[model samples]
Target: MLRKIIHVDMDAFYASVEQLDFPELIGKPIAVGGDGARGVVAAASYEARKFGVRSAISGVQAKKNCPGLIFVKPRFERYKEISTQIRRIFYDYTDLVEPLALDEAFLDVSNNKIGCPSATLIAYEIRQRIYQELGLTASAGISINKFLAKIASDYNKPNGQKTIEPQEVEEFLEELEIKKFFGIGKKTADRMYHHGIFTGKDLKSKSIEFLIENFGKAGAEYYNLVRGIQDSPVRPNRTIKSLGTERTFDENLSSEIFLLEKLDGLVQELSLRLKKSNVSGKTVTLKIKYRDFVQQTRSKTLPYFMSDSELILDVVKGLLFQEELKDSVRLIGVTISSLNTEIKKLPFVIQLEFDF
Candidate 1:
């Protein structure tokens, strides 16, 4: 059976919101991020893109490219509110919606409540409503699976919609650039290019065994993607196994005091989420990413499940203190896992099941 999937991506989300709030900046080149010398671009407006400005680029460098670029700091709270509004719009169609980030999500409208057979039409309507109601523009891609739909969404971007039927998958993929394929990061794309796999057509010609030998686990995925054999589902909403919070700064943190302040914010956010879900966690995980993009995580399991913000922060701070990383920190996150979903009747150090 051909499952209908839709990938909806907001256009220049943070920058677009800024333009929406400040009408005067609608047509101007806008960069939503810190404007400090060491700051990085969080999101760039379409106007900025003409001058080769982009997210993650240094603010100093962005200014060099687009001399008149306007820099605005990110308003995460506003973004989250807008994201909630968008997610509400998605639930109007189907509950089978999987949010990828603040600005993007996948909807499985194959068996929709609206009784709409055409997922493409549903995507168009959703985009229209989002623009009319939220004053935002969105691009949507409709296809038989998540991978193809995600790719199709970018094909016609900035308030555009693109559809890929089952029959056209082969021809559609043939012209696709390797870099445009999902999960193919800069490092993977470089290796693929060296191995003569620069395009979807080139990837299609490679044998599964040859790809597996070169790319390991993802090599088999490359084989499936080239043939448009994506079987991944639009995951239905389920109980969250973990709750976490992360922040990637515009500038790297070199001071321990600054890092501790950031960790305080993360702990507060995690505490609120954990309390809201009524979940206590036994394991606390700290993730750190260096300025050079290298990532590492440290986790500690407690003797008992805890929902205390102070203890969580203390454990994370202890882990950070032990690590002797001299590199400036680019990102930091805290996560709570290993939940204690006890039913009260179950004894400690035992697993019990009773059929009702």
Candidate 2:
């Protein structure tokens, strides 16, 4: 039986939350992030987006795009509080919910508690409850699987929902622009264009071997995606593979002394995270992003798992000097992998009957 999947994404989540809390900021251009020259826009309101303001772009650029744009600092705790509330509403329908982030999630309602036969209606009810209970709007996509549901969710933005019936999947994909496909970024789209792959129809015409030869493993994924063959399940309690943190400097740092000082703070942060998660790893990786946007990583594996700040710092210090700096650094991060935490698989029970 075909599974029922719904993808729900809050509209401009961070910015919308700010506006919802401060009515004075409603309907105006606002960005959720620092206003400093070095600050990056964490999220942009729909009004700000109209002026070319977007997330990850420098605050300076966002300000230049919209002179009237207001910058607000991020309140992660508040966001988490709201996210928890939203998840409660999701639980009313099904337990098979996979959170992509604080603002979006995938719900498998094939065997929902509410016994709602129609996934479309479940999505609609979910959106309505969110607006009524939290004063926040959401968009939803309902389809037979996660991939199609995710794409359909974006079809109607801000406060709308779309349903892609299984019968419509083929034509919907065929005419769709290659660039609009999820996971196909600008660079990948450009490469596809060079090979005369301009739409889903074009992508479907290529043999799997041809795609694999050109794009490596990702090419096979693209081939399968175009044919709507994705079978990855929506895992509710996804395993914690790795945990780390990074900082992007306002100004580039060229000296090893300064880099080492930065590494100390990162180690402290990673250690705290490890303690919080109750997990330790044997591998420590040092990530360096140069001023030119080039990234490099150096990793070292130890004989035993370690989560102590001093030991992690020692490992980081060694990895830092193992390779000479190729250029001034713009960002640096630390990651711990090969975790000692065991993964417990969730039992899956087959649905004997479907209401639909």
Candidate 3:
């Protein structure tokens, strides 16, 4: 039986949320992230993108590109609350829901509860429900498999939906830029560019052996992917590997005293979250993102499981200060894992205030 998959992605999720909650931000270029010279754009409103502002770009550059752009610090707690509401909408249709992140997911509705067989119809309903219930808009892609669905969803974004029937899959893939193919990152695309492989058609012309010779094991995977041969199942109840939170600073910090101050705040948040879920762990992790977007993590395992904020803060402080200052730090986060505790995801609640 041909599987029916729907990929749903929230358009500029963080920025859109900002716009939804703040009417003044609509139609204005805004970004949700740090506002400091060394800060990075977490998400950009569509308006901001018009001026070339985008996620991962430095806040300084974004300002230079769009002087009128508004920068708002990220409110992760509010975003998480909204994400839960969106997930509930997905579960109403199918139990086979695989979340890619807080703002995107794949739903396998081949055997959905709706009794209606058209996945495209389900996509429409899901989008409609999200906008009506949460005052948010989502774009959806419907296809026979996840890869095509994910691609199709992005074709018409920010409150739109697309369906790629099985018969149309090959033609669709052939016309795409090589970069759009899953697993082909900037580096791989550069290599493909050097080799004169520029599109799906270019990739398809190469032999599996040649791809393997050039790109090794990943080449084999890419060869199959280009042929539209992905068989990865939509894993709904995938195990929660870890529960952690991190914050991006408005400004990159070179001062050890300032970095420790930020680290302490992160520890407090992580500790509260752990306690809320009644979860504790033996492994504590410290993540650091440099001003240039290079990220690294340092982790240590303790002899006993502990969720005490003071202890977590001490561990993080050691991990962070043990080494000399590298580049200015742009972000810091702390996490504890290995508890095998169940994750706490808030259920979606209908907002009666939203009228659609």
Candidate 4:
């Protein structure tokens, strides 16, 4: 039997929630993030996007794009409260719910608790409840597999839904751009474009061997992806691999004095999370996103597993100053894994949320 998958994505989640809570901010250009010269945009409202304001861009740039843009800080606790409400609604239909982030999730309804034979109806009902109960709008995509469902969900904007029937898979993929396919990033797409593989139809014309030759290990996977043969299952009780928080700077920083100073507050945040979850690890990973958005990670595994924030900070400092950066950094994040604490089966783990 085909896996009836539904992908639910919220519309401009964080910014919309702000608008809902503060009526005066409605219909205005606003963003959620620090407004300082050293801060980066966390989320942007639809109105702000018109002026070229985007997440991860510096606040200075965002303001330059829209002089009247209002900046607000992120409130993850409040967003988590609303996300729980959304999950309760999903549980009414099926337990096969896999949350991708705080604002979007995938649901398998092939054998749903509600016994709804039509995936379209289930998606419609889910969207209506979110708006009526939470004062939020959601877009849904329904299909026979997870990959197709995710693409379909983005077809309409704000509060719309779309579904792809089994029979329409071939025609649907043929017309889609290679960039739009899941797992195909900008770097890969650029390489494919150079080879004249611009769309699904162009990809379909190539033999599997030819694709493997160009893409290496990913070639076999791409061969199946273009034909819409995705069979990855929806994982409800997904294990938490690692937990971390990150900060984006308004300006790229390359100096060690400034970078080390930034680590103090970052360590404090990581400490809080470690204490809250009661997890200790020997592996500490440091992540850096450069000016051009290229990211790199360096990690260290200590002899003992400890959740000491100061110790983690000490290790990362060595990694950072050990090598000169190729470019100034726009963002920094830290994570600890290989944990000694118990692994809990969780329905979801909050990640960076976005409408796209």
What RMSD, rounded to one decimal, does every model reach? 9.0, 5.9, 8.5, 7.2
lDDT of 4 by residue, 1-356 (tens): 47788999999888989999999999999988767755667678999999998776767788999999999977767887898899999999988898877788999888777867888999999999999999999999998889999999989977999999988999999899999998898779999999999999999988999999999989998889789898777888655567786888978998878887777557655654554344578888889899999999998899998766678889989888777888999998888888774566655422221112
* Steric clash count of candidate 2: 0
Measured against the true structure, the TM-scores of the candidates, in listed sequence, are 0.72, 0.79, 0.73, 0.78
- For model 4, which pairs clash? 38-250, 39-250
When 1 and 2 are scored with TM-score, the better candidate is 2
Model 4 TM: 0.78
Candidate 2 clashes between residue pairs 3 or more apart in a chain or in different chains: none
Per-residue error at 176 for model 3, in Å? 1.5
Q: After superposition, how far is residue 297 of candidate 1 from its true place, in Å?
A: 5.9
Candidate 1 lDDT over 1-356, as tens digits, reads 67888999999988999999889999999998756654667789999999999976667889999999999976767888888899999999988887776788999887777988788889999999999999999999998889999998998888899999888999888889999998898779999999998899999999999999999989999999989998777765434578897888989998778999888767755764565355779999999999999998999999998876788999999988876876999999999998865332322221122110
Task: Enumerate clash totals for all models, in the order shown.
Answer: 0, 0, 0, 2
lDDT of 1 at 270: 75
Ranking by TM-score: 2, 4, 3, 1
- How accurate locally is residue 137 in candidate 1, as Cα lDDT from 0 to 100? 98
